[model samples]
Target: MLLGRHPCWRQNPAFPAIKASTFRLRRLPSSNPSLRFAAGDREPRSFAAEEMGKPKQYWLLKTEPGEWSWDDQVASDGGVAEWDGVKNKQAQKNLKSMRLRDLCLFYHSGAKARRVVGVVEVARQWYEEGDGGHGGGGDGAVDVRVVGEMRRHVELAELKGDGALKGFALLRQPRLSVVPVAADVWERICELGGGYEGDGGDADDGDGEG
Candidate 1:
């Protein structure tokens, strides 16, 4: 579903307003001396303009395993599906904001717990569904493709228990379906996600997997 670029997005006016949450990172007491980011000089990776403004962007998607499983998304072509069934006004607005080619994280919510298990790409823009289509009161949705599963799951318990992520939105607003992850937060997650490992001489080998 593609929404023509909103005039407000260009002017950067705040239309859909939301409250802010605080997050902080702290080192965990671990014997694994190879985790170098623990010293705290690492910064999160920021999306370059070339990386942004594309038809797609990165997002975190949450769903209960009983309703939709990671395998369900993988079963679809390119893992694309019209993301619908949203009732929350804020969540709907976030869906409307997504662009094509955006990347998304597969988060399993509910009793199984919140964990980023995989990655997905936006294949379509905001489009209206139901009989009314784009012009009427129909709800909004987007097509997403599952790109790859996270090599390891970043569990909510692990995140909340981590000192560094003390201020993470996942900790503050557990109910928010769509939230922004700061550059720092992104890096920290990637690190915890196991993006960095195997530096040859590095001790401990970093064999943890999700």
Candidate 2:
């Protein structure tokens, strides 16, 4: 959740110890033509849904409540914000893999009441930050739009206690800011969050926070 320096980055050997200035700049295609990948230093990773033979994927994005709360994201322009300042290499890779319209759970970590507070959609794909140069420092930035808030927040305690969520990445890799969510897990979490109302002529139920 801490933008500038992540404590996990220091402890995780998987992350490379490279300076921000060393990253090279390259332009990559984006759903939004105006937005392009800021740094082309790394090998190109395809985020096309067809290439992966998958439908819309789900993700979980963790942020400290104090630094960037659900309300803060909802208040941003068009209920969207540039999810930037990610320093961890794995997290950066996750950002690169995101495709437009991908739904994400907005989890509030490091809060007195840590929980999944809301949902967001990827509005734009990867792009550079600020001046969009090699020295700009923001190598990973994804535009996310707030889809809706959770009708009832799902606590981490509940997730850990649920047997169905035993293999969830959040529990295995607590420090990872961005994590992929399995389709079934996504549906289960949505139900737990009071967002999913089962099919049974209950679609009119005010379950979704939006």
Candidate 3:
């Protein structure tokens, strides 16, 4: 991940200041590079259990409009629905690991423009929904419910343009479909989502992120 130019600030004359808290997930030495799961495997651990008996981790889930829309989730018989059809090994891993109460950032992809539209909560644990693509079965899946929508759509361009999101994994690993959201990143995004008061333009009251 490279730090590109910020339109708001000019290049400094001296050495640039680097944020000391930036995190990077190091790849473990392995013979294989692929992160997908093999046939007949179970889902990952529950993310909800990882936090204070509450879902603290944040995540982003991408779905095409033609397939499933945010409105579909909201209009469902109940707010909760199963999240399936995840074939990618890594994405499966993320879904399996998600806790029932985890927060998800709903994104619309494969369209004219990509944007994060709403927030959803994980409602069920990872379980094998049905027969996977292979003759085998037990693919990982999750259940989610639409919690709320962003006041303004957070476009990919805006996400790429934000200086505050320089270290976000969503920007760093765009193709990772499902990714972890650090606590700091989660709070920052909540702040970005209009401070969770339905007000999109209010500045933080000097309370810092979260």
Candidate 4:
């Protein structure tokens, strides 16, 4: 489903409001081994040339349902929200590697409902969050838009027992909030989530109250 730009975003009160000056937008260094970022020094470059028509990369994003649920994302202005406040170094790197149009599975990590509830498309790339100049560490953030809500929730227990998903980072590194999803794995999870059929279908905006 095509998502439009929306100006309203509801921030989690737990996270302090970040000032625009605190972060600077810069392109990822080309020397980095991963060819994740779009080439050239221009702002907001398209991936058509850099991707060479390869399947888009996929990711899994975890959030506590009570804190920031799928409904919250859909309700956000233009379905856009900043994926910020990540403190882990590895998770921060994953955020940096994200490119526009990358798909993300929105997983609810709440104790009561640990499941994949919706999908999101990366709308913006990486920007660094400063450490308040106190020497405290900061991390990267991205902007994502709600793509669709899963018809059926894919629970954690189901994935853990499925041999096909054994190697998924969500199962291996349960503590990590952000993780990469292989193309095959992404398809499989979508299948389990009630035949999502990729980007062609409309996203269900119903309350994903799992």
The best candidate in terms of TM-score: 4
For model 1 the TM-score comes to 0.60
In model 2, the Cα lDDT at residue 20 comes to 60
TM-score of every model versus the real structure: 0.60, 0.67, 0.63, 0.67
Error of 2 at 141 (Å): 0.2
What is the per-residue lDDT of model 3 for residues 60-105, given as tens digits with 9 covering 90 to 100? 9987766677788778768777778787788889888887677888
The per-candidate count of clashes, in order, stands at 21, 1, 3, 1
Candidate No. with top lDDT:
2
Q: What lDDT score belongs to each candidate, Candidate 1 first? A: 0.66, 0.81, 0.72, 0.80
Model 1 stretches astray by more than 4 angstroms: 1-57, 131-138, 196-210
> Of 3 and 4, which scores higher on TM-score?
4
State residue 77's C-alpha deviation in candidate 1, in Å: 2.3
In candidate 2, stretches whose alpha carbon ends up further than 4 angstroms from where it belongs are 1-53, 131-137, 196-203, 206-210
Ranking by lDDT: 2, 4, 3, 1
* Overall local distance difference test of candidate 4: 0.80
Better of 1 and 4 by lDDT: 4
Candidate 2 lDDT over 116-164, as tens digits, reads: 9888999999886664421134666988988888878999999999999
> Rank by TM-score, descending?
4, 2, 3, 1
Cα distance off (Å), candidate 3, residue 102: 1.0
Candidate 4, 1-210: lDDT as tens digits:
111222322334455555566666688787886665455445665667777667689999988877778888888889998888777888888888998899999999977989998899999898776543111344657889988888789999988888888789998899998899999999899888874535665558465787
Question: Distance (Å) between predicted and true CA of 110, model 3?
Answer: 1.6
Give me the displacement of residue 175 in model 3, in angstroms: 1.6
lDDT of 3: 0.72
